[model samples]
Target: MLAPTTVPMPGLPERVRIYEVGPRDGLQNEAAVVPVAVKAELVTRLVGAGLRTVEVTSFVRPDLVPQLADAEELWAGLARSPGVRYPVLVPNVRGLDRALAAGVEEIAVFGSATESFAQRNLGRSVEESLTMFAPVVATAREHGVPVRAYLSMCFGDPWEGEVPPERVADVAARLMALGCTELSLGDTIGVATAGHVQALLDALAEVGLGVERLAVHFHDTYGQALANTLAALQRGITTVDAAAGGLGGCPFARSASGNLATEDLVWFLHGLGIDTGVDLPALVATSTWLAAHLGRPSPSRAVRALAHQPSPS
Candidate 1:
């Protein structure tokens, strides 16, 4: 067992990468159809905030996720920032086709760590899902498009309580073997604790997986996202997935909340002297703008508190 103090907390990395998922994960669950221009502006502002890895949209069928039906139009409209990598979620071959047609160079595929959640989310078994993605990953490699695979419910599942660490590792290993360049472990329902996260990392290590290819995505439903993130960082994991204004929730999981707010994560990282390359004030401004457009108050505590402070003229 690793001692708490011995874990290398190393004062945040020199340059941490933040993958902004607001346009895709954040908006997909919303009932309202956010205008394509609004989505474009949001992505633009995120880029202005220094977020380089933004998930622009999902290429799923309109009948399934109607919110992202304008994937092509939205991707086409965005001003591509030089050096910024814009990736879209592709559920299958058809979605990959659409994303490629829209000129996307990177894509994400998803599967769940639990069987029941996998069945509910993808309507297929875990093995079947991997089989489905085998060709997708191969094709992506063929076209020189990198693939990021998301293993949802890695810590805990709503349908299946307390997912085993070994199960999460197995799924991650399979996805990595399938040619996924990165594997994002998602605490889909926000039920993970620091101890649980450490245990999961230990299990992954036991299977010879390094923290280099791993990223973490956590929800703050239980207010454990940041704490769990810190634990992952101590274990040497770098990349983090977050949404602006805390604007997302799992459509299949009841009462589930969004991924950790980007502003809050940036603030935490800054306080720890980690370099995320993001401008907190600009991020706050963008989060506030997006919250207003959604007709909802900002869910990010950092954004709300910063917005009320008078700026120096």
Candidate 2:
């Protein structure tokens, strides 16, 4: 088991890259459609909070994900920040076409680590999905849009009992070979443990895949996201995907919860002396705003605790 307290031997970067996915991933699963103007404002707020990489929205079919039906409008409407990189998810060639038309700079493609999940979620076998993505990735490269591939269900799958470590490593290697500049491994249902995280990392290393190009996306469904994230950090994995207000859940997967809250992750990083460049107080306020907009309480424990404390006057 990889204990969170097991610090890296030495020479790891002190700061980490936090890819904020609240505006996109977090809001997509909401029951009510957040207005496009509100979405743009949310992105602006995240940028002001010092997030350098924010996933604005996806260029998916409106019929598929009605929440992101205004993808093009959202992308065109947002106040673009010079420093932040906004990446949108593109499922296939048609999705890539929409993204290209919207002037998207960076695009993300997703595939599952298990064949069953891939078939169910993507309507294709794992190998077939990769084949389908080859042209999409190639086309994106030609257009000078960097691609980041997401390997879902890296830890566990609802259909499959336990996904093997080798399976996750194999899919990640394939995505990297397919010209994905970076790969984000997702614990889609948030059922992963610290030991499972280390085992997967060791397996990936065995296949010559370095941790630098890897990112971890964990859900707080089982209250293990932060601990798993720490395990990844201890293994030299620096990039992490978090959602503001801890908003988001898989529509297809039942009983799934939100991704690791950005506020919570920021708190963890701050305690470790790692600088994320995000304003903790401002982020807490943003989380509060989002929760109020959704008519729910803040899902982030850190944000909730901070909300109750007396503010510095």
Candidate 3:
């Protein structure tokens, strides 16, 4: 088997926790609905591949994202493994209710940095959307469930191009104030550059949200996800959000591409002599398996390169 030469990078974390979002974010944009059984199996395979945190499904309205309409059934069918964290996306109080009833251990709520995205994705203004999430976050806290808040378009917006870093920081501060435990900054359109990534992190830090409580979720639309991620890592970020096989794009934001692939991230981290606790070949095999189910070749460069390699005889 071939692998990147290990060259340690200075000032990088020794380990990174990859938050796998394939089953939810990846398949949610697919036009064809994936079976619940396949979804369950995909989650299991990702965990087996050594991904510690896997986001399984979302509790959003079924009509909105028909691909995830089987959230309850999928969660019920999963033969969850011990010591692996499975979080579900909950859009509103109603979504949170469904997740709690299904006994979800963790939940995430989606917010937007710009007013346009807030209106388009959540059907409300920025303030209105955060207002809606307050009680959801509060209720989840009351139930002892930790909530992760996703603030999309932290870099640029399709409708409102070039979001100000200060504005992103303000939205981030408010979301943190809503009793959320962690925050994932999303490059929804994949328009962020390395400098922009650093700037956003600095802005968040200025608002008292340090790198420890933050995660980076970059899309590869313009092929800058990896560079942006490196910038975040250099800034002391230890959590990254990626999808197996690069399987997801935002349904609401059509310009967005699939997320930063988990395999690719693992490859980069390993090359830098950083520990991810992921089995590279196993992660690639899992993506290859998922690509077959989706009837498309994976967009992940690492998966494509490694999945076709001849096994050592």
Candidate 4:
């Protein structure tokens, strides 16, 4: 059997990529509609805090996700930074077309590991949903725009409990074959444990899918996001997706909580002596600012802890 190759084993990269999804995933599920200007400012502030890749928004039907109704406007308001990426989520061909017209350089497509979640969230069977993304991916390839893939419900599904890791690996391999430059495995219901994470990574590796092409998106619903993230890091999976202020939940999965807070993830990364090129203080300030617009206190423990720290006089 191949030995476990986790972090600190010359496998983990010293520099990790934090794909900030706060602007898109976080806001898309918010109850209140976020103004385009505020959303644009949130992206700017997060980038100011050194987030190199921020998902600005998704291009779903406005009737379905009103929070991100201003996807085009938000994109228009953003000032592109050299060497920075702003990827928007595109579900199908139409969404991809909208993204391309907006001059998007990179975009992400989402699929589900389970059929039930796919039907609930994507309105189709898992197979059919992936089929829907084929043309979108092909079109993006023609335009020289890179595509990242997301597989939700990788761990457990509300309707189908205890999903097999092989199931996720199967979908991951297919997504990679479908022209996804990177694949993010998501614990949509937030029930993934540390053991579950390592097992899944091992299964993925068995299929010739290494950590090099993978990322993780975890929710703090059961308070296992950080622990699960540590397990992923130990496996040398460097790219982690997080939401600033921990501000998000699955509208399709109402029982699920928000994502792992970006501030919280950054705090964990910095404590491990890993470099994310992010300023914790600056990130916390951005969350605090956004929290006010949302009319709620920031949900990030790191942000709250830092908020109490005495500032330099």
Candidate 5:
């Protein structure tokens, strides 16, 4: 029998919450039309694997993201478990209105640290897009629903090469001040390295933003998600966002790959004795299920490995 595991680093969070974005961010980029029933079932399986925070779907306009057009249907059919939080992405006041009407308990807003990306993705400057969300954040806070702000292209932008760490921190600080309870710094193009991740966190610290109120969202375009996650963890970050089966990529970011695979992140965290509360075998099974629906193999190495793992008698 193998010996019990111990964390190599001290002062790390005993338990890290795996922010599962499979049902939302993962499927958002799928060209195939995913049924509401399938989306609901995916969320159920993820929660069964002990995922506390699952992004169920997005409230983006149907014309913009037809993949999640059945957001209301999915939410209605979702299995509700005590203590599990199902948050959805809401891009504007209209999205927020629909989410609130559906009884959403938490919501996420998207933005960018770079002006060029902001203009291209959201059709406004970084500052202008931010100003538009002030009322949305305030209204959400009024109803006691927690808000998570996402800053895309935190590390690198396709149009803007090498985003400054301080610029990333500035946008993050602004989001926090806008009544967002937490900020999810997104490596949208997935060009971040371990050193860049560390430097960004350090810059946030310098601006009085503690790791407790921050999360990291990474992609595996260059296969740096796991390494970047470790760097963020070492800096006291407790929340990380990932997509099951490595599904989804940024449509606005050119030549980008899928988001970091939840299975890969789980394997790394469990090996470090960092509790993510995710059952690896079950999580992998969920990914496999979705892969069949997508008619493609999961891009996650851990999912592929676990699917082929021999069952013990």
Candidate 6:
């Protein structure tokens, strides 16, 4: 496992938090439901590799996302790692109830920045979905739970072309208004480029949402996820969302592809001397093992290269 040369970037954060979404977002879109034990192992391996924040599973309707139907079972049986945060996605109050029952410490709500995605994903208009999340956020807050808001389709929509930055900002502000401590801007369709990434961050700043409250989630559909991420990092964003082995896509959006690979992200960050506290070889090996379970090769370039690298003479 060869490492990248360190060329420290100017004006970058000393440390970047990689929000590992492999367990939840990565598995949700799988055609086959992974066993609860395997899911638990994945989280255990990721935590072992130094991902402090891992989204373990989603509390969505079981029938809707059968792949994560064992969320409760998995969470109950998962080995808790000290100093690590395990967050779950709760769609509405019912989902929040299940999460609360499992003693979830952190929760994230999914919202759409466009009406088309709102209807398609959440079965409601943008405002109606927000109305639905209101009680969920309120209840979680009452339980002393911190909320994270995921805003999908922030850049472009497959059905609706080019979403406006101002529109995204408005929806993001409303979601944050619901008491979400962090907001992750999602490039759901993977149509966003580096310029689009900065523009949206600028728009959010205009609406008083600073980079401190922001994280970025990008898909590699157009091979832009890493570049878009770099642009966001340049804008002072310290949190990034990535999935191991580049495992998942939007179940609702047919064009959506796998997320930014955690391995690839780590390689790029390490090259620039940014600390992610992740062990490169351990992370690659984890993705490699998980890929074997899925019966496919990993989509991450770094994983493929590192996992198959020749031993040094």
Each model's backbone clash number: 0, 0, 0, 2, 0, 0
Cα-based lDDT at residue 104, candidate 5: 97
- Of the two candidates 1 and 2, the one with more favorable lDDT, higher being better, is 2
Model 3 weakest lDDT span, ten residues long: 304-313
Which residue pairs in model 4 clash with each other?
A: 6-234, 7-234
| Model 2 poorest ten-residue lDDT run | 1-10
Model 4 lDDT tens row, 109-190: 9899999999999999988987898889989989999999999999999998989999999988887888888999999989
Per-residue error for 36 in candidate 5, Å, reads 0.6
Off by over 4 Å in 1: 1-12
Q: What would the per-residue lDDT of candidate 6 be over residues 210-307, giving only the tens digit for each residue?
A: 99999999999999998998899999999999999898999999999999999999999999999999999999999999999999999999999999
Query: On lDDT, who's better, 1 or 3?
Result: 3
| Model 6 misplaced stretches (Cα beyond 4 Å) | none
What TM-score would each prediction reach against the true structure?
0.95, 0.95, 0.99, 0.95, 0.96, 0.99
Task: Name the 10 consecutive residues with the lowest summed lDDT in model 6.
Answer: 304-313
Q: Model 3 off-target regions past 4 Å?
A: none
Backbone clash pairs in model 2 (N, Cα, C under 3 Å; residues 3+ apart or in different chains), count: 0
Q: Report lDDT (Cα) of residue 135, candidate 6.
A: 94
lDDT of 2 by residue, 43-62 (tens): 99999999999998888888
| Model 2 local distance difference test score | 0.88
In candidate 2, the residue pairs with backbone N, CA or C atoms under 3 Å apart (3 or more residues apart, or in different chains) clash, namely: none
Whole-model lDDT per candidate: 0.88, 0.88, 0.94, 0.89, 0.89, 0.94
Q: Write the per-residue lDDT of candidate 3 for residues 104-182, one digit (tens) a residue.
A: 9999999999999999999999999999999999999999999999999999999988999999999999999999999
- Better model by lDDT: candidate 3 vs candidate 4: 3
Residue 210, model 3: lDDT of 99
RMSD of 6: 0.7
Residue 5 local lDDT, model 4: 25
